[model samples]
Target: MRRTLLLLIGVFLASCQSGKDQKEDVKQEPMRTPEARKEVVYQVFTRLFGNTKTANVPWGTAEQNGVGKFSDFNEKALAEIKDLGVTYIWYTGVPHHALIQDYTAYGISNDDPDVVKGRAGSPYAVKDYYNVNPDLADDPAKRLEEFKALIDRTHAAGMKVLIDIVPNHVARNYEGKTNPNGVEDFGAQDRTHMEYHKDNNFYYIPGSAFAVPNWEGGYQPLGGEKNPLSDSRFKEVPAKWTGNGARSVQPGMNDWYETVKVNYGVRPDGTRDFPDLPEGYEYKGYQAHADFWADKELPNSWDKFRDIAEYWLDMGVDGFRFDMAEMVPVEFWSYMNSAIKLKNPDAFLLAEVYNPDLYRAYIRKGKMDYLYDKVELYDSIKHIVKGYGWTDHIPVVQKGLKDIEHHMLHFLENHDEQRIASPDFAGKAELAKPAMVVSATISTSPTMIYFGQEVGEPGKEQAGFGSPTRTSIFDYIGVPHHQRWMNEGAFDGGQLSAEEKSLRDFYKRLLNFTINSPALMGEYQDLHFFNKELNAKYDHRILTYARWSTGEELLVVTNFDEKKSYQLDLKVPQELLRKWKLSPGKYSLEEQLYGSVKSELLVPAGGAGEFRIELQPLESRIFKLLRP
Candidate 1:
């Protein structure tokens, strides 16, 4: 009997120890904030959003090819946009720019066709800072009111409004008819006799008269239309430096000749004429930068842009997208963006800075909220999508910029890039699925999509002044594929084909999941190297990673192959498994993007965990591990 009692006691002790081991193995990870929302910016060229015309005539007049008005973004249209998981709507080309349309009746001077780009002028060449584009208003007299109402409508629809702020330059004819009582137009008080001055807003070529560029390749103002203003002459006594810093009296066709460069107290000899930022200002926040500039004397150009930004902020603009931000000095942005933040602390200041070396300086010292990840991430993905590069290069790019990944916004399509469905790109919108998945979930950065990218806009129309493979920002033209999604103002996919509908549904599902997933906002670990060394079937065309938060763990895998299927056993390193505190057991792997797809994850004792995954061509999966 004593022997039997001792055996029972030994068995009880063994059971207790086993229970303790199991408890320790299944220790829960610390809880984290699950509602960390990722910003999804929808950049809609304001002039192209609502135009349902399919007549894509090159160099067509606004009368021939209908212009989309500000009123076109009605409640229904906004609802459709908001339903796409968009947090911000960047209303591009909202400001008054130099266009060919004559608004002389409204006390606005007509832009010379010799200087303007197309029927609709370049949005980068601003003519007035205080007014909205007259072409966008249903009634030209109430243009500002119409824009304000649009702002209200956008806010009511649960999204903020962003407009462009062209600081580096303005139209060659910088006329601001709607300037406020104390605000003067750019270059109004400039000393034209000298080439450079501390307060001069523009640099002038002394004793040189502006001459029109010799139009080549049969290109003419308005496609050789015989408007009175199309006489190929502009009245300027002293020719200013071209927008591209060209000093010739007449700029070449390739130069940015439609606009003139804005002087920011920088001398021709590269000497800064303005006060420099104090030492250690690079590590400061916007408020400190604002405070530092509050009492300091600044250049006239700096104050001018700050006033223009504040004016728009007062008019309910939530943010500004600075055009060619790298062209302007970083010091100027510190002052301008700080002033913007002072007015509205939550203002989103996105910039177009292409230089990778200048990215950190712009974001840190310039106080910019986000910069385009075009050169690194976007370029790499473009090559991969074109079937030229390897997915192995992506992890390298991410590791290099891991510190600033949140500030580096990722985008598959934007106004500056060719459409994904274009023959020059991937030739099919469906092929971008894996690329989009990687772009949206790979980091904690904002994801941006141009207006018609979801609908497979090929952008093949040879719109005037703009080449094929890119939608025209200069000409008055209709976007064919986007118009089908527009469905004649119903804002529904009434005219979309089955393939198009499926593609759009895929985008909607992925984007919504991105904003809602906590793991995406949490920590990221690259599993590409781990799998490449373990799984024989894994190739350079495949990418794998893991992301986890308190209650969510996600394994993201993407296959960039256009014609191959990958059947491989993806392994998670033992170190990461320990970091996740995943005990040895069976867990359910369920897909989050599309429902009803699942697999199993088997974690054996004292070894790397793995799951058998089969990826079809251009397929991506975000599998969530259902842990016990």
Candidate 2:
């Protein structure tokens, strides 16, 4: 039954990916805008990658504030990624947070004495959106300068640079004040006009930041019929409705304590305290919608966010990578995109929207310029490799990748989910190399490489039997383990292990492939899903696709299958297939050089028989076919 389920998943993933394909199918028609140029983006979680001698300097040491500096580029760490031919650097969450950042008042005891591998919290809990984190950019006056310098460095080293942006909520207590001392919540209407008590704290964002032992989820109301009287039990019901009780943001639906369900049309005190909202929205519908965003005044909220983005742009950030982008209204993104384009035309607006379902609309609506490709990671790479099986599901996932090739963000590791040591990676360095390689430099999408990925570091096995660590976004799963290596090597850290060396080399080669390939940079991404049969045995575990640039064609054939072999049949572009040493099977390309440069694979895989390649377990090959 488990095997069947896995097979089913492989097929589904190969076709319709994380809801993004459904959104794409609906086709929201917007007036055509001129296309943007191609970009080869590489993501780095500054702390987890490598500690530069100047940046962190200690290759093995993991700093609590994470590598400490905007210019903290890890040379040995980056060598592998750069070797894969990096074009842009998406340094994930490098911003700093002030000492006063905490949110224990809202609930989860926001205080953990032990630092995870000498690191502070995640960069998302923004101490001050207006200012760069001191740790990332210490020189307050030269903070923006440092960012520009980093970008210059990236460009000089053959890459562009981007940073993450967490806009939804600010740290509970930044600079000893709950609310940046009057930055204005900005979304809700003037409360004084509505005649509400000042000390009530409802409708006002809290002015405290804590370690939030628990991050709860569920809807909260923004504005509603004003409460007639102050009630202490307000903590017991939906605060958005009856002005009630506590709500938590803990992960998983299993957590009931984290939320106090809100009643949109009905108040908790039951006096019918709801108001009419935007056109076509009922009182109940409005409240439900508010819960989704954890914000009700979305109209104004979005406007404020757009302005905030402008402020950052003015500060000279290349652009932003909006966190949990799907949570934001699609309409709001359209507005933000339009506004942002007017200011920073070439700004790189990448979004942390993990699913494939939302990418098209996010991109089409202008809410985001790029999003992570979960399908490619889960079904394409992880399932085939970790699950260790091959079946009819391979081509299905490959086809999905083909459809959304241009705007997808390809990655094997990031700050979220389990570390490389978890079940996903399964402790096999050899498997990780091919898996990481295919993810980073194959398919014509921007590649996002996490900090420790290059060295194949198996992160700590999450605390609380890994549950608490799993749910804690402030600190990712990989940080703990990485820190051990740092401590063992003593702040200035140890030499790279052999496993680390090989893994690093694999990524470097793949990244360089993209940097050198011009075919990947074309305005449009042309991908072909080979092995088109509905039930080929190797179909589920194998993925095959080719990218076509203006004058270049590259194909990437990767086998996530483990110790399984099956007969394969694939379609070939008559023009290019014939041009290459003619063969019937599909081809693959080096992701790093898709559009920057090109290389033809003599034998992309283990050449054993039938003009085909015998792949040893998890293996990936990049081939350059003659351009049509």
Candidate 3:
């Protein structure tokens, strides 16, 4: 009886193994697929990303003001960010900068308070290129390794990582303690006697010494706290130029005195000391720019910055967001970006250039992949949301940039912009829903959102450097709303209100759809004219447009009016009907977002398709066509 039982058990195990092998033979091969649509970047202030503290004393010391650390961004936190439909995670303020905090035991020097902006220094005023901010790491000695682990974790969560590259300036007390063996600090090989030289790393005033600005208005360095280094005196002969190119030894208090201007062979006069690009070089590619700089001699500052950028890239950074890119000469960018692309052709390069006229020049010549659309789209949307502008200007902005619309990255808030929920701005976060829908769907360019914008983080703190309405990038403080979502590093929205959770839900749906849609990267057509013809009472605050690709079509309409609801008979133009080859028929118009909302479209014999849409104040709808 025992032998018979053993033989039956062996037969049963063999049958199970044969079934598993059959299932494996029929399994499909896994493959990597390209991203379907344009990317979405979520910008997070590294110091404020995970801090849960609420104590925000003005001019507080580091202990009084707790900070977020690199370890806070573990696998679970990163997965939550990825689930939010983000393609790139921009970790702002990651570099080692001059701050009032003392790190002397680690062989690093503390910054003088008269120069540093806040207890935590400005991230743009970089102190060392090869090292990260020690304040961001649990183990200060392992800061760089911690950041590398962050990069690895971000990639593991299927998101790219970007950090800042402030090429135009560096900290006033620039030091390179963690630089590699062959690297030298800026100004280490400079000739300080001359005002300008082709190879000098800094611009200098001819015959003056650096002077700290005279203080007034109840403002003192360290808020009147006496320190051994806060004697209010910094010694310097032949003062270097300020970050804003202030030539005087005594720059105004408002000037960027904490940083020094980098010399890129641009002389005190308005002439270039290095070789200029060939005429019409803006239309060329990175390879052409690379060839142009192949045999040319560049300045010392350019070489230094290139080395710094390449060092970061070699450490697995996907890209860089350039701060004050226009302040540096375009010729240097042509050389630097070419070298970068040669190393990593798919690197994402974004520049902060505000001038509208120089947009094309910087994009085409400097090889920048994207630029902040702050002055145009963001400004216009802000006015419209503030009840100062009309929706008619939206088409004008889009038409004016028809040729280069793909290069503009849209954003409603960043480290530099005011919070949308601030009283100085729209005073209501919900009022931005329509504007965000338009910003994300209007063009093929990318879209970015600040860390707490979705949960309505009001920048109302009395931090040291700046006032309310804009989050202080200079202070060590907690972002209240985002911290709630963080939930003591759980990264769950346990403390969020019902309204805040709903707002976040809307954002999730819209952003997830954005990353999955193919028609978003296809052709666009404005339907405002056709819809206006359908009803003279069609609200001027309402805008309509259409986007279509080979097998997909989408019609997007937004109501920007916060005080009035709108019900209009929207019309599709005859030109579009002929192009789409739809005859007289009825079709279902299903709302892509909030799938329960649906409408019907009536196509008359040889004419346009008309549909009636009712939108609440600041409501947006993305309708997809389905067969009747």
Would you estimate the TM-scores of all the predictions?
0.94, 0.63, 0.93
lDDT of 1 by residue, 399-495 (tens): 8877677788899998878899999998998888899999999988889999999989898987788588888889888998889999999999899
Q: Write the per-residue lDDT of candidate 3 for residues 1-628, one digit (tens) a residue.
A: 1122333223322321112111112211111133458789999999988788889888776688789988899999999888888999999999899888778888898888878888888998999989999999998988999999999999999999999999888999988998899988899888899999989999888778899887768777767878777776777688999887777798777778889989888767656667767765666778999999888888899889899889999999999999978777777888899999999998999998776766766677778888999888999999999998888888889887776788899999998888999998989899899999999998888899999998999899888885788888888888888988898888889999999999999888888889888788877899986677678868679999998776678889999988788878889987887776777888888999898888887888877788889988889999998854
* Best of the two (1, 2) by TM-score: 1
Give me the candidate number with maximum lDDT.
1
- Judged by lDDT relative to the true structure, which candidate is superior, 1 or 3? 1
Counting clashing residue pairs in each candidate, in order, gives 0, 84, 0
CA displacement after TM-score superposition, residue 307 of candidate 3 (Å): 1.0
TM-score of 1: 0.94
Clashing pairs in 3: none
Q: What lDDT does the true structure give each of the candidates?
A: 0.86, 0.45, 0.84
Return the candidate ranking by lDDT, descending: 1, 3, 2
The list of candidate 2 runs beyond 4 A from truth reads 1-38, 47-67, 74-84, 95-119, 137-152, 174-299, 354-359, 375-377, 388-391, 398-403, 440-442, 461-494, 521-540, 562-610, 626-628
Candidate 2 local lDDT, residue 212: 21
**Candidate 2 per-residue lDDT over residues 1-628, each given as its tens digit:** 1122334223322322222323334322211233323355666665443332222221112242234456555344344345556666777665544222233332212322121111245465444455554445545456657766666666556555677765433333222222344455422243422212222213322332212222235211111112222121112111221111223322122221221221121222222222222322211222233343444333344545666677667655677787656543454555566667767667777776544555665565434656777755545566555675443343455456554555677766665644555544555545655566556545446666655555555554331211321222333223433443344334322556666556656666666666556655542222223343433444555665555455565566566655765444333444444444445343333334224433333332333111244444566666565422
